[model samples]
Target: AQSVSQHNHHVILSEAASLELGCNYSYGGTVNLFWYVQYPGQHLQLLLKYFSGDPLVKGIKGFEAEFIKSKFSFNLRKPSVQWSDTAEYFCAARSTGFQKLVFGTGTRLLVSP
Candidate 1:
C-alpha cells in the first residue's frame, strides 16, 4: 500500500522567517504530487503540483517544491514567509491512473506576527 508522510506535525516561527516542510511517499511507480494548504479557517487550496515535465515546480503564494525521485520526496520551501502564511500544509499523491489521493497527516504552521 502507498502512504504519505509529513515529517513535521507542527511548526512555530516568527514573521519573516524561512519555512520548509518535508514530504515523502511510498510508491514504486509513477505518481502525481501535490501540496495543498488550508488557511486558519479556510478550505484546501492547491499550493503547487508536480505532474510532469520539470522536477522543480512553483505554486501560488511564493511557495515551491522539488521532486526528487531517488528519495521519493517532494519538500516544500519558502525563502521568506509572512504571518499570513500561517496554515496547515498537506502533501498528497495519486497513482498515474488513479483519481483518489493519499494525503499526509499534515503540518500545521504557526507564523507569529
Candidate 2:
C-alpha cells in the first residue's frame, strides 16, 4: 500500500523563525498531494495542495509546498512562522484512479513567542 511519511514528529521554534516540514510519499504514479493543518482544538483545514498544473503551490497563511515528481516529495515550507502557526501538520497523497487519501503520521509544531 502507498503511504506518506513526515520525518519530523515534533518541531519547536520561536516566532519569526523559518520552518520546513518534510513530506514524502511512496507511490510512483501520478498523485494528488495535500498539506493539512489542525490547530489545538480545531478541525483539520486544508493548508495547501498540488493536483498537477504547477509543481510549486502557494497556500493559506504563508504556507507553500513543492511537488517534485522525481523525488516523490511534497515538502512544506514557511519563510517565517508565527505563534499562531502552531498546529499539527499532515501530509496526504491520493494516487490517480484511487478514492482513498493516505495521510502521514503528522508533525506537531509548537511555536513560542
Candidate 3:
C-alpha cells in the first residue's frame, strides 16, 4: 500500500511571494502524482498531475510541480502568489493501474494582500 505525506501543515504569505509545498509518497512502483486545491467555499479542484513523460508538470494559475521518482517526491511550486491563491492544497498518489487514490492530510496556504 502507498501513503502520502505533506510536511507543511500551514503556510502564510503575502501577495507576490513565492510558494513551495513539499509532498512525498511511499511506493516503489509506478504511480500518478497530483495536487488538488480547495478554496474558501468551493469544491476540490485539480491543480496538476504527473503520470508519464514529463516530471515537471504545470497546473492552473501559475502552479507547477516536479515528480522525482527516485526520491518519491512531488513538490509543488509557484513563482508568485496572490491572495486569491490562499487555499488548502492536498497531495495525492494513485498507483499505476489502480483506481483508488491516497491523499496527504493537506497544507493550508494563507496569502494576504
lDDT of 2 by residue, 1-57 (tens): 799999999999999999999999999778999999999999999999898898999
lDDT of 3: 0.95
Q: Global lDDT of each model?
A: 0.96, 0.95, 0.95
Instruction: Tell me the number of clashing residue pairs for each predicted model.
Output: 0, 0, 0
What TM value does model 1 have?
Answer: 0.97
Instruction: List the candidates' TM-scores in order.
Output: 0.97, 0.97, 0.97
Superposition error at 19 for model 2 (Å): 0.5
Model 2, runs deviating above 4 Å: none
Error of 3 at 58 (Å): 0.6
Summed over model 2, clashes come to 0
**Model 1, 60-95: lDDT tens per residue?**
989999999999999999998999999999999999
Q: 1-100 in candidate 3: lDDT tens per residue?
A: 6799999999999999999999999986789999999999999999999999989999999999999988889999999999999999999999899999
